[model samples]
Target: MSERREGALDEATIEARLKAELPAWRYEDGWIRRTYKTAGWKSTLMVINTVGHLAEAAWHHPDLTASYAWVEVRLMNHAAKGITDKDFALAAKIEEVVGWQPGAEGGPLEGTPTDPRFAYVKYDR
Candidate 1:
C-alpha cells in the first residue's frame, strides 16, 4: 500500500518514505543504496542474478557492484534527473526482493569486485 502526504517531497521525505515503505533500503546523499553480503564469489553471482529479476520487475534499475561477498546497490531516476517519488517507489519494490536498510551497517564483504565499486552488475537470469 502507498501512503500519501502533503507538500512537495524532497530528499528527506523521499528517503523517509523509502525507509518506511521499502523497509529495507537506506537513504543516502541523493539516492537509495542497498548492500548484500554473500558467502563467496559464486553466491555473489547468484545475488546478481536475483537483483536482475528485482530490477526488471520494478522497471527501475540501480547502480550495482559485486565482487566476492558484497553487492552494493544504488537507486535513482535518471530520466527525472533527481530523487523523486517514482525513484523511492521503485526502490521499495526492489527492497522486497533484496533486503536493505538505512543507517544499518553492511558488516563488510569478503572480497572486492574486479572493477570499480560503481560498476554495474549485469544478470541474464
Candidate 2:
C-alpha cells in the first residue's frame, strides 16, 4: 500500500479481484463507483470526511460527493486504462470503514461482500 509497490496483481488478476472485492462498485466510463446512504446529511458529511482521510492515506484518491443523505465514490487509476489492484484494495477498505449493515440503507457484507448498514453506492450521473 506504500509507494504503489509493483501491484500484487496483474491486469487480468486485478479485474477478477475487482468483481469480488468491489461487488458494490460498478465500472462506468472506466471508473469504479459505489454509493452510500446515511441517516441524514450530517452522517453523509461524516462519511465524506472519513473517505477523504482514507484516500489521502492510501494515496489512491476518489471523486466523492456528499448530498443531503448520500455519499458516492468514483475511483479510477488514470495511469491504468481500466480497473486495477489499487482500486479493488481501496474499495475493499472503504466498504469496511463505512460499516454498512443490513436493512440499514448502507452497503453490507453478504455472500458477495459489503459492510454493515446495508446501503450501497451509485453514480449521480
| lDDT top scorer | 2
Looking at model 2, which ten-residue stretch has the lowest summed lDDT?
A: 1-10
Candidate 1 Cα deviation (angstroms), residue 97: 2.3
TM-score of each: 0.61, 0.65
Clashes per model (N, Cα, C within 3 A): 4, 17
lDDT against the true structure, per candidate, is 0.62, 0.68
Name the regions of candidate 2 deviating beyond 4 angstroms: 1-15, 100-125
lDDT of 1 by residue, 47-94 (tens): 777777877876778788878877887876676656666666666565
Cα lDDT tens digits for candidate 2, 8-112: 334445555667666666766667788887766666887898898998999999988778888889987766645667877788888887764443445453331
Candidate 1's C-alpha runs over 4 A off are 1-9, 99-125
Model 2 TM-score is 0.65
Question: In candidate 1, where is summed lDDT lowest over 10 consecutive residues?
Answer: 116-125
